[model samples]
Target chain A: MKKSINKIVMIGAGNLGTNLATAIHKSGYQIVQVFSRTSESARKLAKKTNALYTSSLDEIYPYADLYILALPDDAVLGFLKSKKLNNFFMVHTSGSLPVSVFKPFSNKFGVFYPLQTFSKNKILNFTDIPVCIEGNDKRTESDLMKIAKNISRNVMVLSSEKRKQAHLAAVFACNFTNHMYTIADEILSRKNISFDLIRPLIQETSEKVKLMKPALAQTGPALRKDKQILSAHMKMLAKDENYKKIYSFVSKSILSKTK
Target chain B: MKKSINKIVMIGAGNLGTNLATAIHKSGYQIVQVFSRTSESARKLAKKTNALYTSSLDEIYPYADLYILALPDDAVLGFLKSKKLNNFFMVHTSGSLPVSVFKPFSNKFGVFYPLQTFSKNKILNFTDIPVCIEGNDKRTESDLMKIAKNISRNVMVLSSEKRKQAHLAAVFACNFTNHMYTIADEILSRKNISFDLIRPLIQETSEKVKLMKPALAQTGPALRKDKQILSAHMKMLAKDENYKKIYSFVSKSILSKTK
Candidate 1:
């Protein structure tokens, strides 16, 4: 058994940082400090969590047991390179970055990736969100796990490589999935159709996956190889070169799956 | 006031047909007949619905008030062309095919498109699914509405042209969205990672659309114009031309939305 993480210093008060800080605070842990190059973001999250805010990396409270770097991927690399890690355990909240990036920078390191899309304005209960965690040492892993378990119900240990692959997979599951919705919104808005018409369909598509694989749930002209309807759809998209390319590429990909 | 439909005949006992048969039956309407090109499917749905089954167009009960052509678009056209009207109202359960397709055959015609993804193995309540209806006459529209209302709480009138556009949008929203899941599945499976890890993310992405525009919910390397990460992701897809093309096309589309 490991001791619980009592004080957390949050770094990079972006969407993930702000959300995580608030969730951790609500879960009865203290967020001792919040840091961001953007002063407004840092101060905003700090006020919410009742933590000290700083725009300087050097100002992070040294007494905090955990530091969550929740900046963008490039910014994460920059923050790691620019700052010297105190003796605290460090982790990132990115989906894509490897834990190795924190290797040479911290005496205690791990990853604390929350596998969900976070928007700054939206408040979510961390209870059901999966938190994928990894650490270089057993105590570090358990301490991180303890922190994760305090805020989330679904925390699991994952290796750096597995987490990277999971992150790549997430690019499709969340990022590309939202991109598809964006395209649908564009198509309907052009026709003056309220996107409200498609909301139930969107929800049902995701819900079905909880019961079955997506490949089995797929139903459309592309999967059916209905050349007539596919051609009609392609012609509809012909006005936009980029959308046409996407339609063709994804249609062909769906067709290839059957083979 | 429009009289309620007394007896109904179902065509195409595939995914949509099977699901609708159950819903209509559960809604206290009589399914007089079930038709399918495959005898096994026709009998399977008929046994479940306690209706007569037929693989032949000639065997359809001519007295049923509503004839739901839930078959494929081409199969629908083929069924219409091969058989003469029995003086009953004809409607299709397709999003793409126009109501005009039924005009050439029936004295009364319309569409009864349920705007939800359906699977034969998965059962769903009709209460929330949007039912898009259009008919040649007021009575035809109202009769379809009665049947639709019996099975669903959401029933609205839409023209054939608008329904076609809505169907096109559905392909992107539901079809392409599921394909994104398939792509994610492939990516993780290659690394022997369980897709269970991403299920929460998938559910949350869809849930976000309920609260905000999907375009606003978008996040990833492509949207941020993070060149290094985007390049890294693109290289990962280099092994498959189709996927690489899709990744580039969608990424550029996302970038365009910011402008």
Candidate 2:
């Protein structure tokens, strides 16, 4: 592979990879090849980026300087085991995994984690997503930052530890919050109440967080410690042990934090 | 105060009461009196709505067409105990409380629960709030619906049973979701990370729910059943018992829901 980190090879055609590659290609960067174990998936992303598709590792283009292993954590680790390719500037887009996972393979390895959840069908505006960059060398760092900064308005250089911590926070903010919505859907559906009723409140809650701290933005019965209503809600979820436990646990947690 | 439903007497100037009264006043209704056990609170709301303020029960306006007992459920019940209401169309704003709680005091008793979380400083656009109306008589129900519909775009005529169920759902959608944000804030702050990083994600998650079922919109390690990342997150939160318990419980709940 060339020493200049311009022509790129992308590994993986998953949600994150597809979005990342598409964004990178849109930003006037060259995406030369897209590789996935599944040929259809590889072709899907490759076609969008106008890159060659391959299901075989041996078919990975040799001239690309930037090799993005935007694969799953285990896949990234497994790929590392093969002692792959030239001394290219390689990186993985993982939240929990440390950047050091690349140290053994290349002299300049890095993390280019996109701090946003990617789903199959959604088209997220790149400007709104935060890109987290970490690297083993300044050259790698700057190159990765150039790519990330090119694609997103929000870019932060966080250590793997800090990135991992941020990822944990995201699980709470995004994952747990989505689960709460799912639970709300379950409760309302059982009662024939549409989820449409609460979407405004949910969106407002998020909008409030933008203007103030989430701690300050927090509200609802739990913050007030309205035990009567809390108990009544708990009773309403009695048939579902998971829902009941979640309700009490989060309500008490909010009370503890606010108090 | 007059026999016409144009005049309203607002009781208990708490968050809901304050917002409810303001929305009603803005919709061209005359708020004759704003009452609270605390003179300061009553005065605060009264000044905003151009209504008279009073702390004493005996000073309540005698002829207002509608009396909104916007107090806590217990306070609402307590007010009903003293037989203090004049024969005005009385209603209490409570989610879980039964509408019949006012039946003993007035022949035209009803419930006017706005199904949205209210805060002291936030200006809620009543146009987005879903007001739930229940009444002892058709006239009371219609009157409550007229006022609710005038101020808000969403109105539901639900019985106490259905309102309670929706209230339970609201706890999950609004209360639990806010707590999730709180937990995310705590996690990030411990590492000195700004909560700003997650705000966009939170907003997007909520927005996704508006277009699709929350169950379909759900993403993250929990839904993917990524055991490694899940365990890693749980370990990251191991120091805080509350967080650890919540992480595991909610993760399992999401897993179950997705499966």
> Best lDDT goes to which candidate?
1
Q: What is candidate 1's CAPRI-style docking category based on DockQ?
A: high
TM-score between candidate 2 chain A and the true chain A: 0.95
Predictions in order: lDDT? 0.87, 0.85
For model 1, residues B1-259, the per-residue Cα lDDT tens digits are 6466878999889889999989999999999999888999999999999999999877878888788888889888888888644457888898888888776677888999999898888878999999999999898898888889988999999998888889888998999889989989988899887878799899999999997999999987787788777787788888978878888888888888886
lDDT of 1 at A58: 68
Superposition error at B258 for model 1 (Å) = 1.5
Provide the lDDT at A89 for model 1: 81
Mark the regions of model 2 whose C-alpha exceeds 4 Å error after superposition.
A1-4, B1-3
lDDT of 2 by residue, B1-259 (tens): 3244798999999889999999999999999999999999999999989999999999888888889988877677778887778456798899889987776677888999988877768868899888889989887788788899899989989989988888888888887888888888888888999888888778888888889888888878888788989999888887898889999999999888764
Provide C-alpha RMSD values for all models, in order: 2.0, 1.9
Residue pairs with backbone overlap in model 2: none
The best candidate in terms of DockQ: 1
Q: What's the residue-level lDDT of A206 in candidate 2?
A: 74
Worst 10 residues of 1 chain A by lDDT: A79-88
